[model samples]
Target: MSPPMIIAGIVVWFTAGSLLSWHARKNLGEGMIEYFLADRKVGGFISAMTYSATTYSAFMMVGLVGLTYSSGIGSLGFEMTYLAATVILMVIFAPRYWAAGRIFRLVTPSELLARRYRSPMAGAVSAVLCLVMLVPYASVQLMGIGYLLEVLSGGAIPFTVGMLIAAGVSFVFSWWAGLRSVALTDALQAVVMLVASLLLLGFITLALFPGGLPEALGSRQDLLKVSWTFPMFLGLTLPWAFFAVTNPQVVQRLYIPSSVKNLRKMILGFSAFGFVYTVLCVVFGLAAAVKIPGLEKADNAMAMLLSSVPSPLALVVSLSITAAAVSTMNSIILTLSSMFGRDVVRTFLPDISERTELGICRLLIPVITVVCFFFARMQLGLIAVLSSMASGGLLMQLPTILGAFFWKKATAAGAVSSMIAGGLAVSFMYVQGLKPLGHWPPVWGILVSGTVFIAVSLATRPPIDTEDFFSSLEGYIRDSFGS
Candidate 1:
């Protein structure tokens, strides 16, 4: 494919996305609530699209595809498990998060923890942990765009150039009108991601494999077997299983829908989109494995396969990958900034004006982008591992989250201690490349964090408002039932 063809595809996509961003800005409401949460008035369909787009990122096409190519059906099982876990968790917890956000007038999920525990340190610790751990996952999106463009263009576009282009676009979309622009662009990009994936799959079926997938996979039946070791599968799937509750970017989405009706629609719509997209991406990897076998780097399977397709079709598919990466990165930047402002900074000042807080969040967008840009430039390990690593480190939050909602004696000391201890455990293991006793770092992290949370909570006093908080949730449930 010529550089000009790929360039033209991205230019057109960029133009349309920019127009959407500007249009979203026109209707953007004032203040922090409007900027970060769309004033909690987003419609069902848009809510669904934004949630889907944010959750399924460049990871699907690039990282997950590559994992499937190399690891076979086990990768599919891992992702499917994640999908199932996410939906189940959302069903049980989304309403609670939505109610808490409205009841507490919270701007971020971390704030909910603060309100629940009546300890600013609990929220501040959670927020800081997110800011640190989420960077690796965020950088994976930039790395996806970098690898796709660089491989497809045969080095006509350097990886760094691709990373910068993605980062710039993400920053712009998020900066324009906060969540309004981000969500609107996300809705457009989500459609492109789904439609383009379906087209690519159909093309591969008809053009690449005339007979059917089974017929095409004649000699690679072994690829369908679950070859991954028990430890490897457990290490990867554990954090992702709790992703809906742990990952801030997705957790924040629970607060966006206009009403309980819209929230249900959001959950159902995301479930449908997620299942289809996950299948498409996994199949794509399997197809690439059969078409272009034994690529040294599995991450390049999608790129190498694209290079063999028609130039025009390749350009469209490549643009879809770009859209996935940009939409996800921008959402992370937006969500993280909100945490920094509402949870971390406000913890100290306690009296900062809303205008200043919003301004701070907007200002941090590029700064965060630049930091992730540099990290992406490092050419990290396999995309799937890096992404899972981020989630694993974030898995430390699971204990704190559970305690906040379910445990009466869960104290701020327990929350802060468990997070700090669990987070450090994961970080040290990743840095040293250590996996003690065949389990991954997050496996160890959950153990340490959960134990510490229990011991410390039992030892310390519960928050004063624990009863009130629990009662509020029960009251909301009663009111909902009555309505």
Candidate 2:
């Protein structure tokens, strides 16, 4: 794609997104709940689309496609496992989260922990941990767009410019109308991403196999097999399997559906969208392996495949990838801003007015975007490595999050101690290049944290209101979802 053509594509995408964001602002109301959760009024389709967009990101097309291209069917198994596990986790936790959010007026996931554990420190700790892990992950979205633009424009568009554009778009949507704008734009982006992927796959298929779609992917036979060893598969899938609860951005989403029926629709719709997108990404990778052989870096597989495509079609696909990045980034920024305002800021300034809280959140959106923009500009490491570390680091939170909903014995001390221990272990392993017994860092983090959480909770007294909390939560869930 030529420089002007790439620029035009970006212009069109940004304009469409801006218009959607402007339209969504009409639904926005006053206060933090309205700003952060779309006033808890998002419909099923938009909820599902936002959730899918927030959860998947450019990782699906760029990172996952690269993984599939390099590692074969293992990538498919890894992602499908995540999808299946997410559905199960959501089924168990979404109703509880929604009930809690409504009953408690919770704006952030961390706030739920704080309230359940009766400790503001728990919310603050979780918020800090989320920021530490997710900022790098958010940076990867910017980096993905940077790389995509550079590749598609033949370096006529520099990486920094791409990062700036992505950050700018995300900031505009997230700052304009908060979650309302972000969710609406996400729905549009999700459609573009899915349609573009389908179109790209069709073109690649027609170009490569003029006769018909092949029963067997030609060449790279080894690439078609499950190459990930048992430990590798477990290590990779463990953290991702629990992503719904572990990642605050998606977890916060559990609180956004307007009704029980909408929540059900959100889960089912995301499941279908995820299944199709995952399959398309895997197929695209396999096709790339066959059509563009001998790529030194597997991460370049998508770029190489795009090079073979017609310029206009390639631009469309590239814009789709950009949309994926922007959709995810905006959601992350919105969620993080909410956490900063509700969980962190309000902890110290509990008396702050709702207007001030809303202002703080709006201000933090651009600040977070700028931080991610700089990180993307630095190009610290492989996008996949940083992204994986973020997921692995977040896995530490699963024990506390799940225990908050189900276990009466779960204590604040337990949650805090376990998170610190698990986070340190994951960080040390990542920093020192340690993977004991061929297990991933996330595996170790989960094991250590689960043990620590149980031991500490057992050693400590349960919160005084634990019984009441559980009883009320259970009653609400039963009343709301009839489960």
List runs of model 1 lying over 4 Å from the truth.
Answer: 378-388, 481-483
TM-score of each: 0.97, 0.98
**How far is 355's C-alpha from truth in model 1 (Å)?**
1.0
Question: Count of backbone clashes for each model?
Answer: 0, 0
lDDT of 1 by residue, 299-373 (tens): 888888787788888888888889988988999999999999999999999999999999988899988999999
For candidate 2, the 10 contiguous residues with the lowest summed lDDT are: 211-220
Model 2: residues with Cα > 4 Å off, grouped in runs = 213-218, 382-386
lDDT of 1 at 132: 82
